[model samples]
Target: MTDPADMIVPLLREMRAENLEQHEQTRALVRALDKRLGGVEDAQKSYRQALTADTLLSKLVTGEFEERIEALENKVRELEGHK
Candidate 1:
């Protein structure tokens, strides 16, 4: 009968190689997912900032509702001068 150790050696080496290949493929997939998630997170942050900036700009434009704000300020100044 053939030596059992000799018969098992080749089988063990093949299994090790397959395991290594699977491990490398899994690592690659994880890296790809990480990169995609990073991009999504960055995009979300940028969009939030842009929306905040838009809201601030809208408030600034609309907060100054009347064109007579300067006249109102001058009238207040005149009243303060009398006091």
Candidate 2:
């Protein structure tokens, strides 16, 4: 009594609408993830810069300490030679 073609047309329209909605949702999720990823990358860069500064400061302190030690040793050698 009912036509199969008529039934198929309504079902196809429903499927098309659902597909469009899902595509929009996927696009929104991708945009949110991209924004969050940018923040993470910025934080990583800042951390690397801090590490580099710390390393440089440590090297400068160590160099100063080494120079002071050498000066003390030279003074001790001079005093001993005089005696």
Candidate 3:
């Protein structure tokens, strides 16, 4: 006759191993998503800064637009922080 406790031990060990493997896989997927999100955020920030600079330059050709551009840029930066 089989010892029931001995039989159960191997089954439990296998289950624990499988659970650990699944947990590791999930952690890896979350890390990858985090990296991609960070890249997207950085790109967005760069684009906004470039746009602000361009607007300021265009206004420069006309004369005395710094105050308005500065205010707009400040608002954009504030919004970016919220994101």
Best by lDDT: 2
Score each candidate by Cα lDDT: 0.93, 0.99, 0.93
Please say which candidate is ahead in lDDT: 1 or 2.
2
Q: Model 1 Cα RMSD, Å?
A: 4.2
Candidate 2 positional error at 78, Å? 1.9
What would the per-residue lDDT of candidate 1 be over residues 1-24, giving only the tens digit for each residue? 889988898999999999999999
Candidate 2's C-alpha runs over 4 A off are none
Model 2 clash pairs are none
Q: After superposition, how far is residue 17 of candidate 2 from its true place, in Å?
A: 2.1
Clashing pairs in model 1? none
Order of all candidates by TM-score, from best down to worst?
Answer: 2, 1, 3
**On residues 1-83, what C-alpha lDDT tens digit does candidate 3 reach at each position?**
99998899899999999999999999999999999999999999999999999999887865656677888999999999999
Off by over 4 Å in 1: 1-4, 66-83
Against the true structure, candidate 2 reaches a TM-score of 0.82
Residue 6 CA displacement from its true place in model 2, Å: 1.2
Q: How accurate locally is residue 61 in candidate 3, as Cα lDDT from 0 to 100?
A: 67
> TM-score of every model?
0.68, 0.82, 0.65
